[model samples]
Target: MLEPLGVDATCELVYREMLTHPGEGVAALAQRLGLSREDVGIALDQLSSLALVRQSYEPSGRQRPVSPEVAMRILLERQSAELEAHQHRLALSRAAATQLIAEASEAMADPQQVGVELLVGIDRIREWLSQLATEIQGEVLTFAPDGAQTQDNMDASRPLNLGLLQRGVRLRTIYLESIRSDAPTLDHVRSLIRSGAEVRTAPLLPTRMIIADRRLAMLPVDDHDSGRGAVVFSESPTVQALHALFESVWERARVVGGAPPSSKDADLAPQDAAALKLLAEGHTVESIAKRLGVSPRTARRITTSLQDRLGARGRFEAGVKAVRRGWLPMRD
Candidate 1:
């Protein structure tokens, strides 16, 4: 019955037994439930991890079940928060799907057009990207959103990126501001910087993109699924517009590991401030953690700290106070 809340049958049974027969040892409960001692022990461990049980303060080292009134409430709240995050993610997926459908429809309507080409599937996307990389002559501008890049992605792009740098081709990439705290990703960025690539970070970015030599641009077909495919644009107006967007973001983004951010960045640490903005924007803590590339615990800590600093009772209030104090620019 409690499975929906992630309480397994054994754990729930053990919990119930402990509640009705307070202070009973594992062996006794194991005998009563006709389960192996190991099974009962494992259930206790799971319960402990869930905070449904704790070590007894008495001389005995047996586990103590927390009152359901308190423990269950916390579990329910956590489940509710996760549900909300799922809904928010679904909404984002729907919007991305709509955009993809429109772009695909347009491309289909003009089969002979040279403006847009839809490359459908990972293999096709990689082949096209490789072709673009080979043809690129002047510079490559990119937005690497969706948190810290995976090691596999970094490894795959290394040869291509190194080749560009070797040819003295300018390569500038913007990543999410949260990646600064990720050790491996940060090290990778530093290496790229040393190899003559320009790298910066912003608190938020609209989507993942790559523009080659101001002649061609690539955008993800689905923001959440990189392997799905991408849409390439070569039309002068479309490429030019994408270029303008990159330039605008580049002007505002902070140089990775360079000078301290400008005063306009406000009082909070850049990452924490970014987290606060996300919270205010109605993003769930789980989503915030993913965007920031930090653990949920760290995200929660940042949120709590921001709330304290702003003297706000909750995340929403903290965002309002931050804008009021000029910590964050008021959004339109």
Candidate 2:
């Protein structure tokens, strides 16, 4: 029990023995406790460091063990202080994260002198992506919101991805949770995981993105049709902002093929939670289906199921009840 208070078993045993046999020296205590003299000495050293033992008034070098009451009080005070410091640091970090996110949002809404280059058409985008992939030295973060990927897309990406992995580049990708039901996409994800890539899935994503070396970010000009064009941000507020967005989503996303998040969104499945969010946002069935990469029938099924679970008469009531039940996040 005292282990939680930072006292090891040996130290605790020695401390108890010392309390019982106050007049006994280290040798006597060691013999009684069945511990070697060296072990006893080490335990005493640990106790002294913890202030559970103090110098005895006796001329002999033997140390006197502090009373249990005083020792425990000291330990509790130390623990409290450490916890306070930890919380303070966490608060500071939270504030900094909030500031970064706010700045990133503003930057996206109205870009500043942020170094940016717009590449129109699939050919230009692919050319720049290839060039950037070769230049990357550290890591790549990607948000694949396009739902299910085509066989050709997967095949074309393999060589570049494998080359980066061989060069010891860390790659992390977040795909839509809907892809779990798609065999081809799942197989491609598994292959990437086998090659030392980390993959996760989220219910919804804001856009398709790729950030390389924390210095450049690539975003699709149009989410529905990426072939239209792309925007490449280089070492600017916009890139930093996109990185922040990736990190925020990554934290809430679930690991592919792993167990669902425990107790989050009141234990609702990721897809269920996503559906509720979209419903609350007043998205039509068609729009929700497109966003979730599911067919209209499946989207309707999920929506109907949500309404039934919430005992709601319609989509409006379902959204209201979902918010009241804490099953979905509140949006402004």
Candidate 3:
């Protein structure tokens, strides 16, 4: 307490108190702060050394006016200093971003309409997207039928999303109607919207793919094994054709807007509903389990009489016949 008031805590306390009440008395200030008169005096002295404070004696029962000029000038001076600091930081940020964009563009080697390359792992796909994200300045066209981001994936994608947005790229993503049934996924969608993303939804979907600026795109060669050996990054004719196919499919698909579901939807054990729906869509018990966010045994038990109800030869026949019977349209 007696030592040269610590530069850290004391300085903070003095500044806080001065801003709070420049009219407080030494005794009253000490009482309110739970500090001794001597400590307050020391803090004031320390503050005065920085030209951040001024003290003067007045009549015993009188006070010194807190001149508007002094207060406003000090506040403006501090603000100006901070503004200058931020200006420098902004300049550096812009320079570094420009440099990164140049490097990312160069890494692309060649940028032509519809090119594709096979990416073996999730990491490779992420890297391809990250670089493309930085270099793309136009728009991101996304069609995620399966709603593929996990917590770990989102963490990995944070920097990528930020880089794309910072470069003034716009995003328009379409999700599956089923994604609305997952709370965590809904929360993720909210986060994306807050970050300036445009998201939409569709009913039935396949896997996921993205067309970045109509130049390069990501497409899956196989759909069953999502974590399979590889995915394709295409700037090829077939790739563009696939993108156009996706657009056509999307156009025919139902676009789910507001009022599709509520917060209660995630809690509504969709297992039964989804089981029936998938069964009607021609999915086997095992496939239905994964798609409905349940286990295989649960799906099989739930769909035990599905074929009997549909009067079909087997599960596959049951699914095909059920879809033809308009059962796939009942999502609730």
Clashes of each: 0, 0, 9
Q: Rank candidates, lDDT, best first.
A: 1, 2, 3
lDDT of 3: 0.59
Each model's TM-score? 0.66, 0.64, 0.49
Q: Model 1 over residues 103-204: C-alpha lDDT tens digits? A: 775674466876778778888888887887788899999999867778988998888998999999999999988888788889999999999999999877
Least well predicted 10-residue stretch by lDDT in candidate 1: 78-87
Root-mean-square deviation of every model:
16.9, 15.2, 24.4
Please identify model 2 stretches exceeding 4 Å from their true place.
Answer: 1-114, 263-267, 329-332
Question: Order the candidates by TM-score, highest first — what do you get?
Answer: 1, 2, 3
Q: What lDDT does the true structure give each of the candidates?
A: 0.83, 0.82, 0.59
The C-alpha local distance difference test score for the whole of candidate 2 amounts to: 0.82
Model 3 poorest ten-residue lDDT run: 1-10
For candidate 1, the TM-score is 0.66
Indicate the residue-level lDDT of 212 in model 1. 93
